[model samples]
Target: MGALMLKEIRSFLNSITGYLVIVVYLLINSFLLWMFPGVFNILEGSYASIDSLFLVSPWVFMFLIPAITMRMFADEKKAGTMELLLTRPVTDMQIVLSKFSAGFILVLFSILPTLIYYVSVYQLGNPVGNIDNGGAFGSYIGLLFLGASYVSIGVFASSLTENQIVAFLIGVFLCLFMYIGFEQMSELNLFGNADLFILSMGISEHYTSMSRGVLDSRDMLYFISLIVFFSLATRLVIQSRKW
Candidate 1:
């Protein structure tokens, strides 16, 4: 499992695609945080916070993660490498796990560079380091969970199809739905008491909650369950090849 994990990690890092994903994610966020003259801009606000980056990155990962992981299993199957992998001593679950870990790590790496934003904000605080350290720290944790969940969805989507593009599209739409669809559903008055409950079920709700420096157990469970569910789905999808 560790060996497969390393190989998958190496393949992503060795290829231009990995760097491209990181670069694009960073570039987009940097532009929005620094250059864009919109509501999210810090310059327009009275304080300096990386709140903008965190807010927008969830949406960004909705697309970037899928694009990055779409090929993990899809290309392997398309190139006949998946069968070759199966011939080894690894089980379908291990293969899925290895790829999932690799993809999630890559996604984590892509977000880590944004820590510079955190440091800068801390230093730039009027009273120097007056920023909400707790909130910022919690927000970072929330971001990691969000990225991890997104990567799992990517792995699951990739396992379902040999066409990488289709995998990417499927992953993006599914993630978007989980991230916002439930929350949006709550906007309607139909559910009444159930409305807020359903909205809290979405990834965004939990993510936003954690961003406020409140580490709720329910939120953590939501994140873990998401990762596990998608990983299990990916394993099953690959096992179906035997049928």
Candidate 2:
């Protein structure tokens, strides 16, 4: 698993596509957090917190992750390497997991540099180090989990088809639905308690909750379940190819 993960990481680092994705992800994040003259811009806000940037990131990630993961499994299958890969000693689950982790870690690295924003905000506050360190830390955790959820969803989508475009579209749709669709659906009161159940299952709820500096075990468990469910589903999809 470690070797496979390393191979994935090396491949990503060596590829132009990977570099482009990382650059765009970080660039857009910078714009939203520092440059753009909007809510995310600290200059115009009541308090120059990084909260607006964190709040808007989910939407950006909805597109960015799929663009990054579109080639993970889909390109492998398209190039006919998947069959040879399946013949290797690794299990389907290992392949899925290693690829997922590689993609996830790459994104993590992109996010790490954004900590400069936190530091800058800390320094700029009324008193040096006056920022909500706890909330900022919790928000970073929330972002990681949210990005991990996207990675899982992207992996599952990639496993569904050999066409990267198809994978990308499937990933975007599922990501959107998981992140926000359920929450919106619940507001219609169509399912009553059922709506509540579905709403609670959405990623945005837990993500937003965590971003607010309150880390609930319920939210943590939800993200964990989401990652496990999608990883296993991807493995199952690959395993079925033998039939």
Candidate 3:
């Protein structure tokens, strides 16, 4: 399992995929927060808050993470190596987890550099370091959880198709729906008294809670459960070949 995980990470690093993910992620964020002339630009907002980064990052991850994980299993099957991989001593769950871990690590790499934005915001504050450290820290944690959940979803999508494009589309659709669809549905009052319940089912609700600097157990549990659910689903997809 460890070897498989390392191999997956090494594959990402050896190719342009790893660098591309990190570079593009940082570039987009930097542009939105600095260079871009819009509400996302910190200078235009004239507020020493990195709220725009948190606001825009989820949408960015919706596409970027899928691209990162699109070829995890899809490329394996495409190259006819999936059979060889299955025949290895590792369990299907291990295989799924290895890919998921590699993708999540790549996501982390993309996120770490964004800390510079935080530092910049901190210093830009009137009193220097007057920024809301608690909220900023919480938002970073929320991003980690959000990224992990997207990775799991992407891994599952990849396991379902040998075509990387199809996997990428599926991953993006699923991530978008999970992140916002439930909240949008609730706004329609379709569930009546159950509207709040329905709204709570989406990632947006929990993510919002965390963004407010509150680490609720339920929010943490929701993210963990979402990740586990998709990981298991991917494992099952991998195991289906046996049947």
Q: Which lDDT values do the candidates have, in the order given?
A: 0.90, 0.89, 0.93
lDDT of 2 by residue, 89-116 (tens): 9888889999999989988977888888
Stretches of candidate 2 off by over 4 Å are none
The TM-scores, one per candidate, come to 0.96, 0.97, 0.97
Candidate 1, which ten residues in sequence have the lowest lDDT sum? 39-48
Better of 2 and 3 by lDDT: 3
Per residue, candidate 1 scores C-alpha lDDT tens digits across 26-92 of 9999888878899777667688688888899999899999988999999998999889999889888
Q: Which 10-residue span in candidate 2 carries the lowest summed lDDT?
A: 39-48
TM-score-wise, the better of 1 and 2 is: 2
**Candidate 3 C-alpha lDDT tens digits along 85-119:** 99999889989989999899989989999999999
Quality of model 1 by C-alpha lDDT: 0.90
Return the clash pairs for model 3, or none: none
Better of 1 and 3 by lDDT: 3
Residue 74 error, candidate 1, Å: 0.4
The per-candidate count of clashes, in order, stands at: 0, 0, 0
Which structure among the candidates has the greatest TM-score? 3
Which candidate ranks first by lDDT, i.e. highest? 3
